[model samples]
Target: MLESLNESKKLLPERVAEQIISLIADRELKAGDKLPNEFDMAQQLSVGRGTIREAVKILVSRNILEIRRGCGTFVCEKPGVVDDPLGFAFVKDKKRLGLDLCEVRMIIEPEIAALAAERATSEEIEELQRIEDEVKELCDKEEPHMHKDIEFHEMLAKMSKNMIMPNIIPVIQTGISLFINITDYSLTKETVRTHQMIVDAIRERCPQAAKDAMIEHLASNQDKIERLSGL
Candidate 1:
């Protein structure tokens, strides 16, 4: 009977582990809170130690737990999603307000462009050109070019081939688009010129040149936003 019940689809080990994590979260378990030993926890939850171990491993990898060499596991001193060096917490909760998200992008996108300039491949450069061309074509069409514009920046970040970069790129783009859409500002001729400068720097493999171009592009964008919204 126990085995049959344990095999139920809804009561899987992962679910049980999630429940434990939720409990700790709800109870506001501080760092150094000692979780019950596997044996006792298994008996109490009617699940095996393996489930708890797997759950602990997930949290550990996410920096929520720290398994000591000889001592039992404990919550990390700062347990949360690891922040990228660039302060990348833009898309964590889907409920984040749009303006708050844009503020995050106002900080990150320029740097991503600079990195892409330093490391993008020929094929990636071609892709960015294609994205730019597609946007030009779309501008003449009935619909907006917002998605394509976002894709362009995202592709530029992917060109960098940095491990965590691709992940942060979309979050930044989403925020940028939030403001862009509200303001209805497609890439103007001047914006394209700035991007072209960055593209040229990338083609020449000049990291500093790319970085400066990106900074200028973003600064000009800020000026445009003020002109559009007076914010």
Candidate 2:
């Protein structure tokens, strides 16, 4: 039912935690799922209850588990990484934060678009087209579609086929989206036009054009933010 850790390892508690994570994955244990008690886990893993307790403590610290005083330990709603991994809370200047996010996108997205142009499969390009179409539809209706807007960018990062880029894109975009959604930065004819250019460049397999379009797109966004803030 659960994985057993190697007894030979000196770091029993850590190994126990790893084994618990393996169990969660293997059993498809989702958020709010109850883990077995310390006694049962100890028996299953051939470790002392104390080791199990230590492992549970570690999992709690990592937000993988939560303790209810009377009910016992359960999984957290969303686990693994915290919501704001970049410490955006500590940043006092919202305008500066928005500018910084734009700078990061300018650096990261152009290369991502170029890589995606080179490596993207037919299915990936088709997905990008679908996203672009949705963005156009929302823009036509004059609707706020920040989620769709971010989705298109995230999909581009995924098309790059680089594991790290996909992860980094979400974190940066979350922060950027906070500012864009709060202001009038997300919904506009220029946004749809620029994003369409990026998608078209990628679909045509023009890596240089894709990169240029992506840079131009983010630069447009930065310019809009600066104009609105007069900064």
Q: Enumerate clash totals for all models, in the order shown.
A: 0, 0
- lDDT per residue for candidate 1 within 1-231, as digits (tens), equals 112125556546556656666657876788888766767666766766887787677777767778886788877776654544234344453334444455566567667777887778898888788887777666656357667767777787787777666677665565445434344445465566777777778888887887788778777766665555545
Question: Model 2: per-residue lDDT, tens digit, 1-231?
Answer: 565666665688988888888888888989999988888889999889999989999988887888898888888876666677778878888778978888888999999999999999989999999988998888788777778988998899999999888778888888876755455434377888889999999989999999999988888888877876677
Model 2 regions more than 4 Å off: 1-39, 44-79, 180-187
Candidates in order have lDDT scores of 0.66, 0.85
Point out where model 1 deviates above 4 Å: 1-103, 140-143, 179-181, 185-187
Error of 1 at 109 (Å): 2.5
In candidate 1, position 55 carries an lDDT of 65
> Which residue pairs clash within candidate 2?
none
RMSD of each: 12.5, 4.8
TM-score of every candidate: 0.54, 0.75
